[model samples]
Target: MKSNKRIILHYDMDAFYASVEIRDRPNLRGKPVIVGTSVITTCNYEARKYGLHSAMSVAKARGLCPNGIYLKVDKEKYSRVSKQIKNLVLRLTNKVEFIALDEGFVEITDIIKSYLSYEVFAEKFKRGIFKNTGLTCSIGIGYNKLSAKLASDAKKPGGVTFIKDIGEFADFISDKGVKLIPGIGKKTQEILGLKNIVQVSDVLKISLQELRSILGYNRGEMIYEYCRGIDNRKVSSESKTHSISNERTYLSPLEDKEFIWSEFLNLLVKTHKRLKIQKFHTKTLTLKVRYLDRKIITKSKSMNITTQNIETLKKLMLELFEEIDLEKKIKLLGINLGNLSENKEYQLSFKNIENIKKERKIQELKEKINNFRKNIV
Candidate 1:
């Protein structure tokens, strides 16, 4: 055992969207509540028992559980609740890394060393969240980020587990599926299965040379270390935005090119608004599409200069959209702004300045419309 081991804690909200709906609408409790129309974003535990999970078709989920309640996603409401949770975590530790709106990692080495036992601290933390927001989360405590995340998921819906040493980490994961380890998706799992590496322990028996031959040099080395419970990733709470985007799934597929272009423009507007609010600019823009048959595809383009201008984003996204085979009815459209930078004061070209002026005019017009409606009402 290492004397100077870091104590990392991963906090993940249980069925975040479904849980929030249940908390707000208590009658929905213990029911199979699904949270989307085109694709299942998530469902309550009751729905999970019926084989309903995130990304499954709502229609398929209905076939599985006909009496299940379906609801639209409330982004604004969820964002507000997520912000509350983030603020609460910040009160505990500044060393927090948010994986999503509902999941975060906190480095608690200093707090554990200074004050209470890990168990006591976890209990109090869970109690605190319920008291303030009426939400439950699972906590995982381990020497590294990967172990901590896996530990948190071990017992879910308000359970906590601690893996303090290599022995404990190894024993805990040995019997689990190879896919249980991070980065080993369905494809990688099949590739490993061919090599007779089905369980985490099987990975340990294979030589590094064998792993490299099967899974390439970089990925093979990473998994080899991970199987042995060695992860050196740090918990960081720095300002970083890898991407910002907006997406919408249609209840019915559309085939009209003009309507699809209009929808893309709407999504681009949303992406631009979010980028401005987050104070970010991007050098890459992506267009994501989902066909009626559930085939998902993405096209991305890189720019010479980073930008947050709507006109620039619209141009890039339109170009990506043009390259796609949109003959088939589209079920979803999304705009992804990536290669992000936090440089808010970057020099803009004359064209960008014109775009900014147009944006301001649009905002002014929206404000006037709202004010006029308020006066009339």
Candidate 2:
């Protein structure tokens, strides 16, 4: 069958940041190591015993594991190691989609043919990563991305899992929590929980139309397919850029609307600059706010016409930003310019001439400032 022909592999680095730290500092191997300044980005398995996990507050994590080694994030070091692992993956197959620095999907249907079995290939690939980087990875081999991702997460710190049959995949997730499904975040989980749809099996009880009515159209349709072990997402090596975004997590949560707006504007300017540099016009502007309680809310506005104009984007951004509740202290603010299309040459209307001149002047000023800073450095 078509399902039997496809092979997808999800590769996840085990406790990536913490593992990297432990590898560099042998003394931290068995001890609980927590990485992050304000929020816990990740922790070693030893720390998990104390109910410590990603996104937990560092202060709370300290209370959980008082003697645990706390370390600040070293993004540059982790990124360098991630590149090394990527290079190793590229040597095996170029059909790879790296969703994050530590996790990615690879379509290995063609490459797996050279191996005696899928298990053998997974072990060999795991060994290659460990040999080169001194870090272990878990790999999930399956017929689709969803199954493969779940499989990879099933085992950790150097383990391989394979879910080849659709029936097997369905059985595996049947008793799992609905939150276990990708894209079903806390908000969706709460909504589902209201309807007593807590488990994967509970989702199966509802009809597609019922789910759509509950979650609107798109998300409901997606959940319907995912719960049935029917994901058709391709593992593309050269995926098109869908959005350009910038986000900042404050060391301390801010309550002042004016200060938050100023920070929000900075993110908008940075994101807009990237959009212009990439020569893409965006139709949708999204604002994401993360409250101190770790709950996140997003509001989005889609324009009738696509634009790269900073003024137009700024207006849209303000509209979305205003939708956020300022009564709650917020820890993070993010802006996303999406529904992107390549900027193509077109005859400008008289109305656009002044805006174009203003943008050019701004770009020139930025270039001059950057050059001056470089010279001084």
Candidate 3:
């Protein structure tokens, strides 16, 4: 419905990791495939037909879809493709917030249903992706980010979901599970289960005070409002980089140099992808380690050049992670990129005046480079 507030769009890459896998291996297009390491990242809709989905136990997933194929995650490839997708979206709106590796919220202040009609956005985005690197995305449009996300998720596989009026909110969420709201984890769901809170109406039936008593004040208030489809958070356009990082707590703590090397590679690749997509370069790379006792250690290194190159990042990460003793149970590891600069502006300033002129010219060139991904990823 019409509102004076911001028009937020939630865009999600449908089964992103799986979609990318299918893009690379065309033969897997209609097949069921799961991408993950120790857990299932997500299974294709085809796999879903056999009762497969993200976070499903691997053994159960295998039992559910005996014919499905499983692929180990390729962080480098996924990160590269994800960057391409982000580049496409950034071209649409300067104000965006990434909520996950594969999902984001775009605030359309200057443009809305007119410039970015749900239909046009979907077709253009899907086309752009297909033409550029052969991938797809699903988009949701609403007056708010949360609603838009629900809209996008209502459909599957390169579809557009949108709501035109706030009056539709009740009907929209009527059938949704209470767990659909953010912050309602499995544990919360179990508690709600005891209260017979399986649906939105179930939450709506409870008073704010009672809900607050169970879910804590802040979270309870959010749930009450969300159940009634009310949100006031703004979609900010000036979301400059404050921090960018990639982290993983191990399935098991091990000191094998080879294993650490591999994990470091994974974290760096993911972090670098985030850096490139944001169009920001960083001079300081921080390495983080969490010991078994939860003691944290961090190391920082400065680079003469800011980059997103995988090989360079991998080498840097290796050197940084190597400083830690493997004998200690390192349960968690991460790579952080800070000391930010706009990759373009930083490069130009480091060079001469002529290069500054060249840099201005290259802004268009960079836009051209991402033009293909600008539509689809």
Candidate 4:
């Protein structure tokens, strides 16, 4: 059976924070604008031309471009503008998925009648965003989510690119770095680099068994398919939260085992309280540890039964920590509870019935004595 051709549109705002700053303060337009302190969260096209990009250090950015305009992030202002953009896109279709704050995927396959209609909608959407927020965006239309995302990336700042077929999608990403493929991050890059696999084409040429050995089972299998331009994910409008987490970063990296254990336990207790407040029960616990050199390792374990019990959660977290196996100083540590569901009433077990009966008898005796004292008075 043949599959229906999908019309997924990937929308990404152009240098979102920096662009918003430039829009409000028109004088900053042609200058190199940086939108963060301590770290470069984003930069304008002028800054990018000077080899400054997001996540670069402020000192390094200044060294690279001495005349760059640095502005603190106004999260409230940006959030309001983001809402305007999201509303504009939602008017076209309800099938949308958000990425971070500025990027989104809209599945317009059901609403659009033909390719001509898709083009028309794209132009109108771009015009609407600029008119309302004074910001420009890049849009990509493709047969699937991955292609759409790559297509948008290919054409930045007020450009639109389309990948209508699988052949076009494969050709577009063939020479690109493996990092460009979704979900292939720095750790995967490090592992694949050791095998001399640096490009998407390299991933395409590697055997399944070899890839599995390097990236473990699930992620390896998925990337093997992604290299060939295949992505089956839907553009869901509302994806439920699978987990909740809390983390702490140390001012200095921790080297002592005792300090690390204490910190881990503290974070776990905070996370558990949050889980209870949210009325959620989880079967899986995940521990995230970032090392001194910025490399992060995560380990998770699943329980035989779901629970919200503090003691049970603590026990599971300790077991998950054992899987880390690294003895290095840690820069950051986090606890995450996953495989979640709403909390339900606990059922009584035969072992606990005797305890409940004894508690009831004690309550009755106390009430009777109080009544006798009242009558004597």
TM-score of each: 0.85, 0.74, 0.67, 0.70
lDDT of 2 by residue, 236-303 (tens): 89878999999998878899999998998999999999898999999899999999999999999996
Q: Tens digits of per-residue lDDT for model 1 on 116-174?
A: 68899888888888888899999999999988999999998789999988999988999
How accurate locally, in lDDT, is each candidate?
0.89, 0.91, 0.79, 0.87
Model 4 lDDT per residue over 296-360, tens place: 99988886557899899888877876777557878889989999888575455675677768888
List where candidate 4 sits over 4 angstroms from the true fold: 1-3, 114-117, 243-377
- As a whole number from 0 to 100, the lDDT of residue 82 in candidate 1 is 93
* Native-referenced Cα lDDT, model 1: 0.89
TM-score of 4: 0.70
Clash counts per candidate, in order, are 0, 0, 7, 0
Error of 3 at 294 (Å): 12
Inter-residue clash pairs, candidate 2: none
- Residue 113, candidate 3: how far off, in angstroms? 5.4
Per-residue CA lDDT of model 3 for 111-194, tens digit only, reads 655654657766775687668767667888787777887888888777887775577778888888887887788998988899
Clashing pairs in 3: 1-164, 1-165, 1-166, 88-374, 95-237, 125-375, 129-376
| Model 4 clash number | 0
